[model samples]
Target: MNNKKIMIYGAYGYTGELIAREAVARGLRPILAGRNSKKLQPLAEELGLPAMAVELGASETLERTLRDMDVVIHCAGPFSTTAEPMMRACIEAGTHYQDITGEMEVYRSAHAMHKEARDAGVVLCPGTGFDVIPTDCLAAALHKAIPTATHLTLGFDSDSGLSPGTAKTSIESLGVGGAIRRQGKIEIVGHGELTRTIDFGRGDKFAVAIPWGDVATAYYSTEIPNIEVYIPMSPRRAKKMQRMNRFRWLLGKPWVQNWLKGKVDQKVRGPSEEKRSEQKTWVWGEIRNDRRGERRIGRVVTANGYDVTVHGSLAVAEFLLDYGGDGGYFTPSKLCGYELVEKLPGSGSIKVGID
Candidate 1:
């Protein structure tokens, strides 16, 4: 049993509620927190867990609220707006912080605070969910299988619908070009700059490169010098993404971005529980050393992305609580070795081999 308390910030959010339920089922007592007491209080009551209503900008109050918590699972959206303040509060409170962010910007922010986190004896880990869990694990596994790996290509295909938070993040990044790591350096390219046909055991599906979180975390996880992350995109959407570069300025404009955000808000709020249960996610990863003329490929068939996110995030919080580790920045694979994938619901070892 953990003596320290766990806090789930943004506990009223969709993913947060899922994580909170999972934590409860696992016999964990998590404090649900958000900006709304009405929403938070009910959830806390329903789950028989503590609840706190605190605004992020209220630094002093927020820090005080966080002070007693051993770890915080931040589930807020876009992360760009929420991560920094929450992270600062966690640091000041000397609390470990984890989040389900897939944004490269957030990963960089958490990474930049590694030294500070270590000094404060606080673990600052982000991307504990669908963003990089399976991919990071795959990257680590491939690197283990081929220690000399220098290049990585990861492709993900999911039938799950996007959460409102995820949709918001995607909207904010619509104008940004794709990103990749080249020779240990970060580089940006047009959306369709790189495309590949990935065979994830089902059939060939064309994938377009995108600025995925793995482009940031996989580098640290596997030390691979070159990496490209892809998600399957319909040809129409692929063309649209490519055209975004030409109208980058337009898309980046506040009015346009806000209008797009409004449209997303009007859409449905992610998939239903039934859909989440019925759908699965397919992930493909490859590691290669062109110099050695060797390649290894791995595929993961896991529960839908959102389901994995909830399980992945809670599992991370539990692990950190059970076995306190040296405080520092870490990715999923970095915090819990590649085998963490096997422990995740609906995820097991894949048959990886040379191709």
Candidate 2:
């Protein structure tokens, strides 16, 4: 049994609560934390673990709170705003940091802090969960099979609907349109600017390119100079997204963001336990070196996105507590082996074919 003090911040949030409960069920007791003591305390009490209320904005207090903790599983988001400050504080406190963030910007920011985290001996990794873990693993596996790969593509088809946090992130992403890695540089494009037919092991489906974390992460992991990430979409919905690109400017308005956030609070309860049980997510990856006439394709089917997030987040957090590492920024595949998927309880299987 590990004795390290593990803390899950935003412990009462939908995804956070599930992770906290799962931690307990696995015979681990983690300190729960968030901005509200009232919300954090009851959950802590029920789970028989310690609790603390510390605002992420409170730098000094946040540093102090993290100073003694061995690992912190940051389950809060719209991470674009929250991840930076927490990452800074963890580096200051010498605490290892892990967060379930899908935001490519967050991953880039963490990677940029590699030197600081390394000097401070803090292991900083983002997208430990559904955000990029499964896909990142697949990318690494494809790269392994086709070592000279120059172009990598990843896509997913999930029936796992959004939680408030994910919905908000999607709204933010929509406003910014799409992103891809071109010749090792990250580039932004219009919403739904790229689309292709992809066989994600089920059959050919129209997939539209989106700004997924792997556009940044897979390139970093495999040094594949060109990369794009996509999600299966109905042709009608794909066209709708393309149409929405015209008004992308409106989505960034403070008033518009506020209204959308309010609606999420009122309507998005995330998936219930039974609902999560029934849902599944599929991740697909393809890598090729056109110059070498080599190509590889792979896919993985996993539990509902949210449930997989909880399990992946826990697995990485526990791994950090037990395995000492030279601190630095890491993708899931970079830190944990690509076979990390094999360790995920209900994450199903990864299948690959080469040509």
Candidate 3:
């Protein structure tokens, strides 16, 4: 059992609770923490874990609490608000930091602080969740499979239900428009502006080009010149969703956003125990070496998106505990090589299907 004290901020949330449960099962003592002491108390007692109350916005209090911990796993969503301050506290305290943030802006901000983390000797790694781990890790594997590959395309299909946090984040990114890298530059593409039909073997599903954090990470991780990510959504709903997203400019109005939020809250429900049990996720990647006139494809499949997120977080925590230095900010793709991520225990749960 590792004696390092792990603190899981936002432990009362769905994903946070999953991480806390996994941490305990792995023989790690994780302190349940969040802005609400009242909620944390019950979870702490239920898990036989201690509770620490700290608000992400409260820098002084957060910093003090983080100082005594070896690592902090942040599971809060809409990371745009929480990632920065939490990162600052971790860097100042010289403690390892990790989060499940899928927001591109949040990742960029954390990446910017890499120098500070390196200087402080603390490990700062974000996106240790379902958002990019499975996809990013698979991208690394595909690149290795074809050393000369210069361009890559990746896609995911999952039966796992969406959580409220995920829905909110999607709504936030609406109207912001999807972005993709083209000819060595980031280009903004309207929702549904770029669409393709993907056959996942389950059936043919329509996928739209969407902005994802992988665009940045893959460009930096591999030699790929251009990369694109697609997520499958029903065609009938795609256009409607796209239209709403395009008008998301109107959501800037408080009343419109609030009304939309209420509607989404009612319609977008999180996974239930039964649904989570039946859920599975699959990912596919294609790598091409235009210079050499060759193409290679790779694929991976796994069960339970939330379970994968928990496993990914544990992988990061173990890496931080064993190999990470005193203080430094890093993305998972940067801290460890792609091979290391592929070799992770649950990684093999992914099965490859290619032509």
Candidate 4:
């Protein structure tokens, strides 16, 4: 393990707590950090870890505080607002950075920072969560099988509720038009532009294209030119999404977004501990070369999606410690490959192979 001290920034959030617990279990002593020292104090005490209370907007102070830490597992979400400062601070502090974001904009911005990260000699990686770990690696594996692949399609279904952080992020993404990779470039597409019934080894389920992070990361990892990502949705919710696209302008309104955010605040907190243990996350991916009519499919079913995020993020952070390479932006598979998924605890419960 990299022996450098680890800091779990936003460690008071739902996902941050999970990462902190797992980090401690792995015999790591992480410094829990977030905006609320009072909250961080109790959690850090319970875990026997130190705590730091630093707001993301405090750049100089944030950089100074992070100077002693070797890497930071950033957990605060709605990453459009939270990610950039932390990333900048990490680069300035020469501390490696990782986060569990599935936001395409954030992924694209991070990818664009590759040169800066390399110059700073610090690895900058995002989507260490369930977002791209299984999907990105599946794309990488398929690309390895068919190196000439020209197009890719990915789908996922999770029998779990969204965390508060995820809910907020989802709301933030609602107004943005859908995205797909076309000719190796990110392109805007109408919501529900591509819908398909994918047989994920269990049964046929309806999936609709949504701007998933894989649209960005898979291309970086596999070089597949055309890509579409789908998520399982019921008929009503699917139709609602499509219909609302016509009124998407309303979603971006400050007042409208604020109202929705208020409602989200009223909702129950993230999944219960019981639900986290019982739910399963199923992901399906396929790559193909239309010219050659060649194709490959892969499936992964892991413990709970949230649990996988916690473990997967920690695994990536730990791996970066011992990694000896010029630091730059990377997808999970590009950095570590399928071996990461294979080694993660509870990932043994995951199933991945050709269809």
lDDT winner? 2
- Give lDDT tens digits, candidate 2, residues 1-355: 3668898998999999999999999999899998899989888888899999999999999999999898999988879989999999999999999998888889999999999999998999999989889999999999989998889999988887888888888878767889999999989898877999998767899999989899888888899999999888889998898898898899878789888888999998887899888888888988889998888889898887898789999999889988677998999999999988767877767788962
lDDT for each residue of candidate 3 in 1-355, tens digit (9 for 90 to 100): 2677788989988889888888888888888889899989998998899998877878888888888888889987668788899999999887888998777777778768988988988887888877778778778878777777778888888877767667777766675788887765667777777788875436678887778887776766675778888889878777876786658677656676567668876888667657766776767777887887777666666656777778888878877777734466565766766544455444554344346
Ranking by lDDT: 2, 1, 4, 3
Q: Which ranges in model 3 have alpha carbons more than 4 Å from their true place? A: 201-204, 252-255, 262-267, 324-327, 339-354
Return model 2's CA RMSD, one decimal: 1.2
* Residue ranges of candidate 2 with Cα displaced over 4 Å: none
User: Least accurate stretch of 10 residues (summed lDDT) in model 4?
Assistant: 345-354
- Give lDDT tens digits, candidate 1, residues 1-355: 4688999999888899989998999888998999889989888888999888999989999999998998899997769889989998999999889999889999998999999898898898898899889898888888888898889998888878888888878877767777999999989898777887888656888888988889899998888899999877677878877877898777878899889889887874867788888988888899999999899999888888898899999888888787566887898988988888778888867668865
What TM-score does model 3 achieve against the real structure?
A: 0.91
**TM-score of every candidate:** 0.96, 0.97, 0.91, 0.95
Per model, how many backbone clashes are there?
A: 0, 0, 9, 0
Which window of ten consecutive residues has the lowest lDDT sum in model 1? 346-355
lDDT by candidate, in order shown: 0.87, 0.89, 0.76, 0.84
Which residue pairs in model 2 clash with each other?
none
User: Across residues 99-143, which tens digit of lDDT does each residue of candidate 4 receive?
Assistant: 998888888888899999999998999999987788887777777
